[model samples]
Target: MKNRRLSNLKYEITKNKSTLLAIIFLTLIILISIFAFLIPMDPSATNTSNILKPPSASHIFGTDELGRDYFVRTIYGGRGSLIVGVLAMIISTSIGVAIGTISGYFGGWVDNLIMRSVDVISSIPWMILVTVISIFLKPGLQAIIIVIGLFSWMETARLVRAETLSIKEREYVLYANSIGETSWRIITRHIIPSVFPTIIIAATSSIAGAIMTESALSFLGLGIQPPTASWGNLLQNAQSNLQSSPYMAILPGILIVFTIYSFNKVGNVLRVYLEPKVAER
Candidate 1:
């Protein structure tokens, strides 16, 4: 079954040129980030004499204001950025699925209570809320991830809750309930599987949002601190030298844009493939 699924995925990618390119870019970026440590240049090491040099044979992406290798720093930054995005997605998705499943499966006051809470939380401007919360926490990867993950789960929760509401009323779920299967078992065995595709679609969007949020936070100096090599902080560092060394800002900005764009593309493709009725629209 897994092999067949994998084969179908490959077929889909091959048939869609845009998705194929997006996947390739995403894969290359992920691989490069994972193996970044293998490269010899130290992202944090500074050379006062080499500061703000333009791209050259020795430094493909040039040097930053701190005289650190911009290429190496950007690579390392991707590692940190992608880590925060992926981990935060996992945290948000877990919270969303659990709460959504409980609220939907139980219905009545449980649903109303959960939905109202989601609404209350969603009313606040999340970026402002995340920024205010981040100010209290120490600036680092984990702090940024936690802030983004917590604030970002509401949408996913709502999506899952809607899906779960419809799924719980289905014949199979009704059959399970009639057979005296525990609510927990019905949710775990039937509802979750039914909602998994929705979760996947939400997860892809969550990852993109998380990465963009982290970048924004770091740009404001509230996220990963300097010398840590996050893409956001890299852009922050380059902001002062925008005229003298625009490449410094442009490089990381391009990376963040492309990464987010690629994720969005992949999500769209997945939505089309997974939800056939929507595709027909």
Candidate 2:
């Protein structure tokens, strides 16, 4: 089964040019972000003499208002953005899987209560909730990540709950229950493994969502403050220079769009590959 799944994934990668390119881009960017510290230039270091310089041989992507190395700053920004995405995804996935599993495996009042709460939360505009919560917390990468992760779990929870509902009804689950296995054991062993594919796809998409959310918050001045370069804050810093130094804004905008697009592309491909019914669509 593992081999067949791997073969399917390999086939999907080989068949879809966009997916392949997206995977390659994501891989390259991740590597760049990881090794960004090795670069000698300090992203935050400023030179008043070099401020707002246009793209040239020496300063690719041009200098920002602070006269920092745009190239280095952008690389560091990618590191921050990717970190927020990954950490937020982990937080959301852990919360979502736990709540979803409990809600679905133990149906009746528990399911109804949890589903109603999810519905209530989902009914509110997501951005409003996140923004309000963000305002209360001290602004920084950690605060932004926590806000995004906490609010971002609803969709994942719903997806997992649906998967759990189906998986718990399977014969293996029934057999486990009949054998007097603990509910926790059954859920951990059979249900979680069965629903894990869904979690992977959801988590992939969650990273993109988290990144976009962070960008929006930062643009609004409620996220990653100055001195720390995130793609979001890079764009935020560029807002005043749009007319004078369009590349300042354009570069970060391009990064945000392309990074989110690549993540979404990968997520969609995984969904189609892992869930054959989705592929049929």
Candidate 3:
């Protein structure tokens, strides 16, 4: 009976529509990443013969100006985009959660210093900051990831700090402190676990934002240098020949829109499930 109850609880956590959609989309992205390495098509191969070709059996998503297969490029491009997004999320969330947890739990001077630093960073325009950094550093996947990760953490820090403050004030936390538990032990066992659900939901939502930021940077020629493909770079190519071969641009744009939409749907679902509903007085 106890085992059955545990299994049911696990099923409840996994069975939500948002969780399912997130899993499916994540799986699809992963498959695309693997396909990038396994697929036969040379993403950089140019077939002048098939230049600007529309979607056909031979070239699934058709060929671009350089006669490269759109389908293959899209898959390959997705690999880079997903990698940057995931890595950026990991970096930002780790830094944010640590700082937020410490600041909220300690309060006083520590909270003021961290919050003031966050405010300074938050005041700048993220895109411009990224662009400036990209200029100083080489423009590539790593550069974009670092830039986005650094700038994006403020929001996560603020969110985590708020959640941590609430959790730290709980009677359970006080009881653990009364029992002479070490600060680190109390924080890890109580505060972090309580705030983790919010962190997860926030992280999932941040991916969509990261993708858009990367796309914008790539579109501006400051992201993912040539010989590499991204949705943004693909769209950049489409700008010149938009009138003649709109498909060249439209396909990648469509994919970007769909990817962002999928992420938003999943994020919304998770937010609803994880957040507590307030009772009316």
TM-scores, each model vs. reference: 0.94, 0.95, 0.87
Candidate 1, residues 1-281, lDDT tens digits: the string is: 55654555666678878788988999999999999989987889999999899999999989988788899999999999999999999999999999999998899999999999999999999778876886788879889998988889998999999999999989999999999999999999999998887998999999999999999989989899977989999989888999989999999999999999999878866765665445322
> Which pairs of residues collide in candidate 1?
none
TM-score order of candidates, best first?
2, 1, 3
Rank by lDDT (best first): 1, 2, 3
- What lDDT tens digits, residue by residue, belong to model 2 across residues 1-281? 55665667787789878789999999999999999999988898999999999999989878999899999998999999999999999999999999999999999999999999999988999778866886688889999899888888999999999999999999999999999999999989999999887898889899999999888888888889889999889998988988999888888788899899999888877766676555532
TM-score of 1: 0.94
Question: CA shift at 84, candidate 3, in angstroms?
Answer: 0.8
lDDT of 3: 0.80
Q: How much lDDT does each candidate structure score?
A: 0.89, 0.89, 0.80
Question: Which 10-residue span in candidate 1 carries the lowest summed lDDT?
Answer: 272-281
Model 1 ranges with Cα > 4 A deviation? 1-11
What is the TM-score of candidate 3? Answer: 0.87
Q: Which is the winner by lDDT between candidate 1 and candidate 3?
A: 1
Q: Whole-model lDDT, candidate 2?
A: 0.89
Q: Which residue pairs collide in model 3, if any? A: none
Clashes of each: 0, 0, 0
